[model samples]
Target: MIDLLLEMFSYMFLVRAVVVGLLVSLCAALLGVSLVLKRYSMMGDGLSHVGFGTLAIATAMNAAPLTVSIPIVVAAAFLLLRISENSKIKGDAAIALISTSSLAIGVVVISLTTGMNTDVCNYLFGSILAMSKSDVNLSIALAAVVLALFLLFYNKIFAVTFDENFAKATGVKTGLYNMIIAFLTAITIVLGMRMMGSLLISSLTIFPALTSMRVCKKFKTVTVCSAFVSVICFFIGVVISYVYATPTGASVVIVNIVAFLLFWATNLTIGRIKK
Candidate 1:
């Protein structure tokens, strides 16, 4: 396995994919902790669907995918929050409505413009070859911003995640922080979608948080564990996919699933021993 990964690293595309994946994993995991705690986890799914629609439109228009998708997804994220706050459509209903509609639009656009070729398949299932040098550079810059922002606002985020009303009462600007979270999440989703695909990218934002929850009790501990787990799982999955010629996104998700199960079992065993 070591030899195989060393051989795989020699390829430029593989290196780009690895770099992008690791950075994305870290950003997603960091944001995932807050999203999960706040019950906004499905936001990532909805935003990824929005990214799919924007990416499809970008492809049809022959524009840069990230440039087109980023702003649109960011707008949709804010819109989703506004709708949730002010309209009858709330919570998961708003997410589902937007998610399904965006997905449908993307499919229709792709069908009409590209006729569902290998590139379309790659968008749905993911392709390591999709990570160009420019994509890696953009991802690195955006991922750094996410990490820095998260660290800068960690205390405020913690307050909002656990108790929005209380945080607002304490004059923490809950709405503004929520928007910041939404915007950051939008960026992470779009960045990840290139490698994890529209359909599976949310897994990167969800699985790490869930897996860490199985073993950790404190919020900070869970957040730390989630970041580590996400990065390790992505690394293992990428290597395994390269060695076995499997789908990269699915392989990463599979590794996450296995990690979650192991964590759950360990927690259960510890509980039983305590009894």
Candidate 2:
């Protein structure tokens, strides 16, 4: 297995995939803690769907996909939040409505323009071959920015996540912080889309936080553990995918599911022992 992994790393595509995957996993996990605790986890799914539409249009126009997708998705994130907050559409319903509509639009665009080729399949399901050197560099810069902002606003986010009403009462500007979360999540989703696919990218933002919650109760502990677990699972998944020729996104999601189950069982056992 070690020799096989070493050989796999020798391939430039695999190396680039690993690099992007690790950076994305860390960003997703960090933001995941806030989203889950705030009960806004599905926001990632919604933004990813919007990203899919933007990416499809970018592809059709022959533009740099990330350059076009990032801003549009971020704006969509803000719009989703605003609609959820003020519009009569409400939260979950609004997310479902926007998500399904964006997905449909993406499908229509792809059908009309590209006629469902390998590139479309890659965007929908992900492909290791999709990661170019330029993509990796941009991912690194974006991931760094996300991490820095998260750390800078760590305390404020913690307060908002736990009790938004109280945070607002104390004048924390919960809305701005919420926007920050949305923006960071939007960036993470766009960066991850090329590797994890529009369909599965949200898992990276969800599974790590939920799995870590099974064992850790405190916010800080859970955040740290989630980042570690996310990176590890992504590495394992990429290796397995490369060795066995499995779909990269599906492989990573499967690894996350297995980890979540293991964590749940271990937590249950520990509780029984304590009792």
- For every candidate in turn, the CA RMSD to the true structure comes to 0.9, 0.9
Model 1 worst lDDT run, 10 consecutive residues: 1-10
Q: How close to the true structure is residue 14 of candidate 1, measured as C-alpha lDDT?
A: 93
Q: Runs in model 1 with CA error above 4 Å?
A: none
RMSD of 2: 0.9
- The Cα local distance difference test for each model comes to 0.92, 0.93
Question: Cα lDDT of model 1 overall?
Answer: 0.92
Clashing pairs in 1: none
For residues 1-275, could you state the per-residue lDDT of candidate 1 as single tens digits? 66887799899889989998999999999999999888888999999988888889999999999999999999999999898878987878999999999989998999999888888778888888888788789889999999999999988889889999998987889999999999999999999997898899999999999999999999999999999999999999998898889999999999999999999999999999999
Question: How big is the positional error of residue 263 in model 2, measured in Å on the Cα after superposition?
Answer: 0.3
TM-score of 1: 0.98
lDDT by residue (51-71, candidate 2, tens digit) is 899989998899999999999
TM-score of each: 0.98, 0.98
